[model samples]
Target: MVSDAVGAGEGAALRARAVGKTFAATEGARVVALDRVALDVGAGELVSLVGPSGCGKSTLLRLVAGLDLPTEGELWVGSELITGPSAERGVVFQDPSLFPWLTIRRNIESGLVARGVLRSQRHEVDEYLRLVGLEGFANSYPHQLSGGMAQRAALARALINHPRVLLLDEPLGALDQFTRMRMQDEILRMWQARGTTMLLVTHDIDEALYLSDRIAVMTPRPGRIDRILDVDLPRPRQRNDRRFLEHRARLLELLHLTGGIEEPLAPGV
Candidate 1:
């Protein structure tokens, strides 16, 4: 059914070619947010971008979402150049950003309403509510839901549009450790069920390993792809598994977080 829903070649491959972004800083100075970044994500595959703060992770996600444009180079989804926002791309930020005044059902239906397709697609609102396990709370307002529940609502909202590529910008970053882990599995389930291409930006290394087929690490300021590491671990990976730990250590080293490397000793010593 998901295959039928998504259609072959409909998932959409993403390509960024020598993409760069710059912003005007204080006093006529310019800040290079990203530089010469090139990456490709296959159709229906999940990839994550992880790096230190200020490394342009969110900037790149925004570009893919069509909320922002690259100052240089180009981005493409499938065969089409990414010129502006499209329903084919759906974005979920760290914050749910649901309208406080709307019921959860209304919020999920909002996208269809915006596109003027609600008459034919209204049934999908309840379908996605069931998919996200929020059926019982359809009448509830955003204030009544917990952080995880609110995020689920947000996901259902985006997914009702059947986005070819789902752009997640730290969508689980605000939850507690346990909730964050649970939501990780929830997101994986959604990815599996829908077969959508996904690009996730996250600060959590383990989350990236758990969800992504490959992990792209970026450098600090003037962010560029430091390396793209393949995560070959099987699904339902054990966090304590030997291979998992190995990958974790490697990513930590890449991020310069483990303090494992020391300066060379003096030649005299």
Candidate 2:
């Protein structure tokens, strides 16, 4: 069950309007990484971005995190324009990136400490540790934990700030199948408990179907949102259900998989 206290606050809405990004290549050539992408994640909504590699999914996520600014257009968390990184938007990448010298508790507390609020918000350290099921590992070093456990610790570190939007850039991509599945559920639980809006970037179509309220499919390089599909399945969705299979087929078709294209019948044939 989700903790009422964690789930109590309202989440911030996220919007990307005509968002574009460009990069400079050799010989002063310009590469368009993203072009006129528009997206929205409602407050507390879990949205996933899925596409082929180099489609700028991670780039778009970085812009949202304010790690990088969009070359053109705008991004917003609630009504405030996003200019740079803020604690309100926390990011977790594929790597846990925990400091080897820091204990789980210390790593989780690092965010609060950086903001000069550790003295006042110290109690949240324990709360988040337990929230991620890491209460017993607080004193353990990062090197002592498994990959999944380390990622959980990373998640707790981000959540301790009570971020309004959590940006996940393939955070579960490195886990083995079983562990990945388990972590998916763990992430969902945390999302519900905290009501934090989430924007997840993943290559796994099944993962997007299983975890997101909607999935935005992007085109190849110079990425653009080709389609946005709503997942209407109920919570704890069944992977083997007919509707689930139908949705999977559709997405695969959009990605040009399954080989067969739908062609209209010739008139009077």
Candidate 3:
């Protein structure tokens, strides 16, 4: 029962061209994190980046979040080149990372307060809380809620800013399996309502398959965009359906997760 999980008209086009990121390591050596990576996410779309450990998925997210600078190439949000972090792009990390001392209501409004606009924007706080299904918990402290609830609050906090692009770095990774599944549905709900573009980083293949409009598979360290596959399946995808399993098997082969690394490659369907 997922509505096509796309954003309304709230998203801004995102583009990255020949982007590269490198860091200095020990012994005067350097480590390249991302290399010649190029990608695009159309307005209101959901795209996922998936790869093995140390593959720079998070690095790419950080660059887009404006938390770090790239060594080469360019990144853009709609017409503007990304030179630094802006309120138009918001991020939710694996850790919800809510403040221990603040109530959910205060946490959600913290951003507005920081921007010195809380006085003018306070009326919107309750709306965003309800948007994430956290209205009843507004007064609750971070420790008073369960992992799933806190993540919801964190999501609400980010959404309240009306970011044009939402970056999710394994936001549901800490939840139990059941909670994770439920949160997936919740994410779709929010996406449809806000129409805000989303770029997600995840290790879960099924999660990518179920949520992404397209999946960008990255190579190991010094990560490159090895390939991007369109998910042509219909909404409310059945994880056990024939096509679903076929895509899953193909993805496993692409990632070398299956026992066969020599399997002939298939073009994206």
Candidate 4:
């Protein structure tokens, strides 16, 4: 079962401490992207990071995904220290990033192929295709599917690896409003089925409210987690309900979008 939050114990599936990243700019000067960021994502839990542009949300995610190394601090998945990319951590980005030449089925099998286990896991491909509601699209190439369908393909591809932690960097951000909402439900359904610990970086507060068990708010630059708000509402939350609106308002206040006087913020991008 999913816990409320990660704690001092071993329930934390993902953990970061004093995490920081800096890059050498064109000049001799350096740019500090993240500063003393600390967070823990419990096993089988869904957590989201919400902040304005250039807050290093994606940078932190890349660190967790092992795509980049932090200039400071420690990152851990289970008891293992993060050193480099591994099949154990799956990632899906804003763009689907599928191979155009391959069919959906082959694309999903790509992970198994890379691990030299296609012979054993070939049968799991169709099951994952079905899991993502793309069983019929298996034979279709990336160019043949709609935007949402291609994303479904991408989801299937990442999930086929069965990573212990899934890092989502605005995977649904590019979709239209309707499609994005539908995909949210799809993600929830899959999460329930797999119970994979997921960390999402989203600019959309409502999306974070809808998907996350907890939301981590961050400062604009030299990013640090400003606060973490627990989503105490029941599962399958209603967007129009009073509790949902209250949480939205609080998130807006934290994001500095709401004035001292409260105002209605428009939903969706």
Kindly give the number of clashing pairs for every candidate. Answer: 0, 0, 2, 0
> What Cα-based lDDT does every candidate model obtain?
0.87, 0.88, 0.87, 0.85
Worst 10 residues of 1 by lDDT: 258-267
Tens-digit per-residue lDDT, 126-237, candidate 4: 7888777888888999999988999988888887777888889999999999999999998887787777889999978899999999999887767888888999889898
Best by TM-score: 2
Q: Please name the candidate that would achieve the greatest lDDT relative to the true structure.
A: 2
Q: Per-residue lDDT for 1-269 in model 1, tens only?
A: 12234333347899999999998877988889999999999999999998767778899999998999999999999999999999899999999999999999999999899889999999888778888889999999999999999999999888888899999999999999999998898888788877889999998889999899999988776788878889999999899999999999888787774111132422221
How many pairs of residues collide in model 4? Answer: 0
Query: TM-score of every model?
Result: 0.92, 0.93, 0.92, 0.91
Clashing pairs in 1: none
Alpha-carbon deviation at 152 in model 4, angstroms = 1.0
Off by over 4 Å in 1: 1-10, 257-269
Candidate 2: tens digits of C-alpha lDDT, residues 1-269: 23557754457999999999998877988879999999999999999998777778999999999999999999999999999999999999999999899999999999998789999999888888888888999999999999999999999999989899999999998999999999999999889777899999987889999999998888777788888889989989888899999999888777653111232322221
lDDT of 2 at 232: 89
lDDT of 1 at 18: 97
Please report how far candidate 1 places residue 84 from its true position, in Å. Answer: 0.7
Q: What residue pairs clash in candidate 2, if any at all?
A: none
